[model samples]
Target: MTGHRLRHAVRRADLPAVAETRRLLRDHLRLWGVPAMVDTAELLTSELVTNALQHTTGGAVLVATLSPGPGPRLRVEVQDSVARRPRARVVALPEDHQGTSGRGLFLVETLADAWGVTAWDSGKVVWFELSDPRK
Candidate 1:
C-alpha cells in the first residue's frame, strides 16, 4: 500500500470544526480505498479533537496518516497546547449520571489497535492507530 496523509488545523471550539474534521477523515479514507475505516476513524477523531478543544485554551492540529505495508495502518493524531497527557480511567458512572462525558480515552483504548500520548516542548499529541482488517 502507498502511504497517504492529511493534516487539518482546528482553530475553533465550535461544533463545526469537529464535524469538518470527521468529513475530512471520511473523504480521505474513501480516497485511500479504505472506506471500512471511516466509522471507527471518525468516532476516535471526534473524541480526540473534542478533548483537545475543550481542555486547552489554544488551537489543535489533526493529522491522519496511512502507512504502507501488507496490512496498511491508519494513524490519527491530535496535538494540543498542553503537555499534560490524558489518562484513561475506568470510572463507575453513578445511577443518576446523565451526561455522556469522560469516556473518550476509554473508547480509544478499547477500539484502537494501539494508542499513546507523546509530549513535546510546546504541547502533547494523543494518537491512535487502526489497521486495515481486510488486508
Candidate 2:
C-alpha cells in the first residue's frame, strides 16, 4: 500500500481532543484496510494524546502515518511543548488500577510493537508503531 498520513492539532486543556484523535485514527485505519488495528491503535493513541495535553502547558500535535511495505506499519505520534520525557511506572495491576490516573505509558509499552519518545528543541514527541498483522 502507498503511504498515507493524517495530522491533527490539539489545543491545550481540550479534553475532547482525546476522543477526536481516536475517531480520526479509527476512520483512517479502517479506510487503509487495517481494521484489526482499530481497537489497540485507538486505545494507545488516546493514552499518548491524553498525556501530552495533561502534562504540557501548550497544545499538542497528533500525527498518524501509514508506511508502505509488504506489512504496512502505522506510526502515531503526539507532540507537546514540553521537553520532559514520559516514564512508564510499574503498576501493581489490580491495586494500581484503582487510582484515577497513571498507567498511560505502561499500556503503550505493553501493547505497541514499538514505541519511544524523541526530545526536540522546543518539546518532545511520544510515538508508537503497530504493524498490520494480516500482512
Candidate 3:
C-alpha cells in the first residue's frame, strides 16, 4: 500500500474478534508512534465492530489507515453486509437506558473527531476518524 494501512477480517459476527481487533490496533498505533490515540481508537473501533456484529448477518472487514500530515489522521472502518443505518438514541431517563445495548454509536460520536456512514452496493461502512492531538 502507498500509505499505512492494515486490513483484518472477522469470520462472522464473532464477539471475541473485538479483543483481537483492539490488540492489532494497539500494536499498529505503537508502531506508528501515536500511543496517545490508542485508547480512543480502540474504544471507538470496538463500538463499531460490536454494532456491525450485532446488527449484520455477515462478518465485517476492519480497515485501519493512517494519513500523514501536520496532524496525522487515524481512521477505522467496519464494513458489513447490512443496508440499515445507525442512530444514536437519547437517554432521556435513567430507566430508558438498557444494559449497554444501545450506546455504541453514541460513544463513537462523542469520541471521534469525525464520523459517518457510507452506503455501498453490497452493504455499508461505518467509519470514524481521530486526529493526533500532539500534531
Candidate 4:
C-alpha cells in the first residue's frame, strides 16, 4: 500500500466528527495491516481533532498518508482555520497536572516520532509522524 492517503473534512467540533475520525483511521490502519498502531493513532487523532475544534472556528481537515517501502511510515495532520499555535505549558507543581486542559501537545510530543505546525494562508496544520510499527 505505497503512497496511500486519506483525507476528511470536518464541519465542526462535534461528537460525531470525533467518532468518524477514529472509525476512518482505524479502518485504514486495519487495511494497511498495522493493527498495533491503531490505538496510538486513534488517540493522537482524537487529540488533534479535539484541539482543532476547540481552538478554532469553522471546520478542519484531517489527513493520513502511508509512505512507500518497507518502513511504510505514517503521517497524520489536522488543519484548522486558526492562527493560534499550540504550546506545551510548563507544569511546575504537581497540582498543575490536575487542570482540565492543556495537555494534548504534550502527549503528541511524547509519543510521536516527529511533530510540528506549519502555517498556511488560511490556517495552520499540526502534524505528527509515526515510524514503521514493525520496527
Show how many residue pairs clash in every candidate, following the order shown. 0, 0, 0, 0
Which ranking of candidates, highest lDDT first?
Answer: 1, 2, 3, 4
Error of 3 at 35 (Å): 0.7
Clashes by residue pair, model 3:
none
Model 3 lDDT per residue over 1-135, tens place: 135888999867699989999999999988987889999999999988887888888889999999887788999999999547544433333555766677777788778999988887777899999999787
Estimate the overall C-alpha local distance difference test score of candidate 4. Answer: 0.83
Q: Best lDDT goes to which candidate? A: 1
Q: Candidate 2 — which pairs collide?
A: none
lDDT by residue for model 2 over 1-135, one digit each (tens)? 799999999999898878988998899999988998899999999998888888888888999999998889999998999646554434445753676677788788889999888887788899999998787
Output the worst ten-in-a-row residue range by lDDT, candidate 1: 83-92
Each model's TM-score, in the order given? Answer: 0.88, 0.89, 0.87, 0.88
Runs off by more than 4 Å, candidate 4 = 87-96
Cα lDDT of all candidates, in order? 0.88, 0.87, 0.84, 0.83
Most TM-score-accurate candidate: 2
Cα displacement (Å) at residue 126, model 3 = 0.3
Query: 41-90 in candidate 1: lDDT tens per residue?
Result: 99999999998898877788999999988888999999998546555544
